[model samples]
Target: MNTSSDDASSTSESVSDNDSDNVPVIKKSKASTSAGLLSEHNKDNNEEESINSMHRNHPPSVTLEDMITDICFHPKLDTIGIASITGDVFMYKYNNEETNLVSTMELHLKACRDIEFSEDGQKLFSTGKDLCIAITDVETEKLVRLYEKVHEQPIYTMTIINEHVFVTGDDDGVVKLWDLRQKGSEPIFSIKEVEDYISAMITNTDAKYLACTSGDCLTTINIPERKLHLQSEDHGDELTCLGLFKMESKLLTASNKGKMYVYNWGEFGLHSDEFPNATKKAINCMIPVTENVVITGGEDGIIRAISLFPYRHLGIVGQHNFSVETLDINNDGTLIASSSHDNDINFWNVQYFESLNVTEPQKGGKRKWLEHNLPSSKIHNRSDFFAEL
Candidate 1:
């Protein structure tokens, strides 16, 4: 793997210079007296504390009112949709000047665990603990259709396959494929793998392959073929989420055991050889920033920037007071939005993301990093960050 593009050292170099200059320096005389030793020790402790405080990530960009279970960004706009535990789904339009609530709907009686916008960005579909799936019109801000009791158990996750199709996973380890053209509540196709509750379902941009995870095992399905493509060995821990990268060449699954399994997409039916321990606590959610870098949100409430090859912790982006529940990057890959169990959502500016890591899948593949306009310098001051929020 080409891990040495723009080393993470560049990011540290940019921030470290400004930080080291701010630390208070202490001078000690060459005296061998106990008083002199005591003074040096105290000075060392103070410096350590100051350095940690300086490196610590800042607070959230906006604090929501309910515990967020899921979040999704619009494909072509500066809009974000968040589903909360209190049956609230909020759509907000955010820019540098303001974060405005575009629409608010209480579409479910219980927690709405997942919400995804259609490819056209004109409609939204959500499934939740109420065992119902609802479709809403984005422009009208009205309920378009409701599929009641679509699953026998609570629906934990959902993914939009295309403009007309989507998939939903229930707590009973069932995966159901839905079609918008159908009027009935029944799924067009369903798959039952194991008894363990289905924790997550992820797909590549093409939506050709679907990967599902449960407490004990991982499975990948070929969507068009409608057959199982791979089933990994029992991980011995509850898997919470999965991420895909490099044109879907790599697959990563995270567990409640604090371990992550990496699989090569080409070796579909084989066991994964790489297992990276990202945290000692559960990694509840993760999103790939590039082919080699991924950001994870853990039960410790910290969002970590981690590199896959020569795996290492880069640093933290932001934090929460409770377990981070979900993470999403906007379609353009310029912003990262994270939600936590503490009822808050944080937005991070990723202007220098491409410079700090490798985004190209193949060594000589057409580089897409320069497609977007990255700011000349990243915004550092938190006061300048959430001013209008």
Candidate 2:
């Protein structure tokens, strides 16, 4: 409802400036005031009030820390890897009783933008503003290989489809596929010449399909065919982040203009037939919890749980003081962890409502409450960030 033209324009400008050294100074304008008024009016609406109440009553437990640029959870381990703007990677182990960082890897010369684990969890891959991708052996704590000049600009995201295959997206709007089987080999697949820069890349569990979302569009590639199978461009603005649902059959795309688009993969080839069903605030990151449920974080410092099946707002987690940059859901889909520019990683129990039996009718039934029992650790100190591995 707060669709002010000025606010949208400012958001678009900020996103463009992010890739360059020039920082846009945000000035208060009449459009901003109108946007605020529109937001207040929407908040007072009955339907909006109901949604707001759900968010307020069962708020997610969020721990704030300062600029966390990237976050990843191990596929087979209980450890979560967090990369910071200060060019550090901290591996934190979480268990039933305690959660503490067991290792820190300072291997980058610039802010690390993304970190990922291989399918077997034997190797860790990271990319940064330094325009290089480094592969490290998690157990030995040694750099196994480094791919320098992988991109002409900063690499923003990376995803490992299997032990031998990985993909990276960079600021130059190129998505390059790397094969670990060949030594010093070039990318087996590359999707350059795209109009906008790619912000994220994701692969399905079967590794059959790959999805890439950029500032203005979403593209899907079929790995076997080695060709782009679909490309959709309905989004009128720059897309900031994206997430794939269940089997890569669905997608959630968010733009800097504070609009979210839900699309069916089948309709992608027929781009004109597909239309965005839902819209939200400017989203920075998105992760799917189920085939129909998605959690998204925005610049407004809120994470929203949205259902795609019936297209409803399930709830919201509001606690961060700054924009959430990256987030990931566990493989089991039971927990969600988010990292913010505010410099902290917060993990939340996702089944909070179901655990309370809120889905079932209850008369004189006892309420079951879930607690955040994970040990608290902060990464606010620079010494902890720069410590040697």
Point to the candidate with the largest TM-score. Answer: 1
Give stretches of model 2 more than 4 Å off: 1-66, 270-280, 353-389
lDDT of each: 0.70, 0.63
Give model 1 RMSD, 1 decimal: 11.9
CA displacement after TM-score superposition, residue 336 of candidate 2 (Å): 1.2
- Residue-level lDDT tens digits of model 2 in 214-262: 7677788888777887877556777777667757777667777666776
TM-score: model 1 vs. ground truth = 0.75
Q: Which stretches of candidate 1 lie over 4 Å from their true place?
A: 1-60, 357-389
Would you give me the overall lDDT of model 2? 0.63
Residue 332 of model 1: what lDDT?
A: 81
Query: How well does each candidate superpose onto the true structure, as a TM-score?
Result: 0.75, 0.71
